[model samples]
Target: MVPFRSRVRCGASSLNMLKIAGAVVVLAGAAVFSQQVQAQAFPSHPIRMVVAYAPGGATDIVGRMLAQEMSADLGQTVVLENRAGGGTLVGTDSVRRSPADGYTLLFGTNAFVITPLLHDKPTYDPVKDFQPVSLTTVQSLGILVTPKLNLRTVQDLIAYAKANPGKVNFASSGNGSAQHLAGEAFRTAAKIEMVHVPYKGTGPAMTDLLAGRVDVMFSSLVGNTEHVNEGRLNLVATTGAKRNPATPNVPTVAESGLPGYEAGTWQAVLAPAGTPAPVVERLNAAIAKAAKSPRIVETLAAQGMEVRTSSPDALRDMLKKDSGEYQVLLKHTKTTLQ
Candidate 1:
């Protein structure tokens, strides 16, 4: 038989444990309720989207357009702010540290994964720190040749590069950029040797290409469409499975010579990780609606971008797929950023 004093002490401890368990259950319920309430009341104020690119650039322009569309859909002001620097690390890392609320978002691109993969020690983990809302744009790059080259098709460029070996120069906005990687991919597929000329941005690189300083470039047609229309630059081949609607006459690099070859950059919206599921769902639906808006569709289409909105899960999968593909290219090409 236990002593009466000891029995009393054990009974009291049991009671306290039960009390603590009851309190824990109550607190958990309260947390769930609070989260639901918060998610329901999301977007009660204006939202901010951080664009990790230079102001007045192609990404900025498209972000502004989508922001307006999202505003219409969410019935709240969606503001786009440019926060460019450190190869887009500055803006992106800031977003990762932001609250996991729907109010602040990151205008993410392929660089989101590619940039971190390039660094020896990444500041943040994209997959672990961010929640993808939706994929908004998928633009295929176009191959532009300077008028001095007189390269009419992908074949012509390949033939010339093969004959001249290391004489043909390919211009890119920067090292490890979509343009640079695409050029590397082309080099691999075509089995040709060409010198790579990397510039700080597309503006200067395109300037050089136009002045006959560089022979060719694999870039987008967003701001360069006018140059192509005016015959200042020769748009030879587009890097997509299908010809871009903006340049239907131009053939894809795959069809021209290298089959099963496609390379381009993409843009999407991402929230900080740990955001509420309901809030993520709401944002995804709104983005889908906004990207399909007639004005947004027309504007991006004219610039050679395809409006390809995707669900949150799909976007996550795309991030993984693109990461693998770009990793392969980086290894094969041995590209180093300056």
Candidate 2:
């Protein structure tokens, strides 16, 4: 026995609520559909891969190699952009600011983890600002000494370093480079003091090391292989967990004397944070495929690089682990950027 007016108002209210609910449901479904479409139709354009080093450098070479293969797999051009400076901070920041639409990616290295620890206040947060797509390569560093030094083994070098103390000099590509960290790690593990000399790049550092301007250097195995082969520079030991296949005669630092000592460089691809998960997965698959390609495997092997691709989650975990380890190394070495 309700009044006619009340009945009419209640009917209108119920109808309006039902209409609003229906609209919301439609909008939600549309949003999900839009995301699916976006994910399915991704990579409709070219991708820019930012390399955080100068052209002709190891990072640049590796990046270009991967880019060529990934370009084929993704059916899109993957362009290489070299943005060198700030110990890889410049290029990394550029990628960090880029849109999270999968068009821009950072071709990063172990320097990404080391440089931040060197700085008192890093410009970017390594863990929070980017999404790891894949790891490309891992190359060990060779402990190269001038033939004049006549250091034949890791123990010999450590003994000489201990006896010489501050007289021994170690050259690196830059202040906070991976090579620099490796040198520092060596200094710590060997419990010796050596003066650290920074250079513009590996080329310049290798030049000085060869010219006897510096007594020793923790150089890239690939970059200095010719010198090692020609006997121009003495390979004391390799800074890897095991001996390098290219130079099986050389012993690792761990085997030589310092157990549990391992230092090396690695490269990986990362996109800005907030990139779609589907797009990240797609990129990872392409990278994994490229790493497994025969041409790529042969090329990297020739350069003394081992092709090592990993899942995104695995890469993230590695980054976390390495960052912590680098923190300890930097502290022990007393290395500070600013």
Candidate 3:
């Protein structure tokens, strides 16, 4: 048996250990509680949303609209910052390097998934570097041809392209833009060869297309609506799987001739990877609410955008799926950035 003094020391040591353990538990619980509180009170400050394109563009316009509505829903200001360059690489890399505190977000587009595939070396990984918050909208592209081309439908365009081969040229917003990808997809699906004429932006590309400098273009419906309505541009087929509500008379590429041929632009909100789950959830909820707002819905509809929101997981899955699809499409089309 131990002596009384030894027994007392052992008891005290055990008691001290218990106290330390208890304190550790309490501290850990406090830390967790503090984190919970912080997450709950997220956006305690203004959030900066990075638009990966220049101002006065579709992404910027849609991002601003969504930011305004989300600010109201989140009870905090969401500022827009344009960091356009490298085909959205500059802004995307900026967001990738930002703190995952939910204060910085990226207004990502289909380019987010396609740009990396176009480049031989990319600065960031879309799926790994960013946490998807929500998908904002999907904008369909109209297959516009110069009326002088006499391409009445997608079939007519395909037949003419097959007959003409490399003689048929299509204009795109840029070399690796969604417009370019859509044209490439069309080329692959239709099994035809067409020259790709890349311009600085949609304005220039549309100008060339309207001037009959280019025979065809896969352009945003919003941008070509007026031209199509005025008969300056012919709407051969839309790039969406279904007819756009704004132009129900226009059939989709799938409905026209090429089945499973759907290509269009999309915009989604994403936070840097490693953002807190609660913060992501909060932002997603705000986005969902904003997407459902009557004014937002109406405004997006007017711009030829269909408002569509998805959960974080859904958005992540979408990015992965789209990335894979783009890889295959790019490979098949042999599309490389110049």
Off by over 4 Å in 1: 1-11, 163-167, 197-214
Cα deviation in Å at residue 227, candidate 2? Answer: 2.2
TM-score, structure 1 vs. true:
0.88
Compute the lDDT of residue 178 as modeled in candidate 2.
88
> For residues 200-312, what per-residue lDDT tens digits would candidate 1 score against the true structure?
55666777888999999998788789889999999889999899989899899999979989988888999999998989999998988988788888877888998898988
**Model number with the top TM-score:** 1
Clashing pairs in 3: none
Model 1: per-residue Cα lDDT at residue 146: 90
* Candidate 2 displacement at residue 217 in angstroms: 2.5
lDDT of 2 by residue, 1-338 (tens): 56998999999999999999999999999977876787788899999999877665567777888999999999999999988777778888999999998999999888887777777765777888899999989988889999999989998898998888799999876777888888888888888998888765566677788899899998777656778889899998888888888888888999998999888999899999988888898999999999998987987686568999999889999989999988878878788763
Model 3, residue 276: C-alpha shift (Å): 2.0
Clashing pairs in 2: none
Off by over 4 Å in 3: 1-31, 148-150, 159-164, 198-204, 207-215, 302-304
The stretch of ten residues in a row with the least summed lDDT in candidate 3 is: 52-61
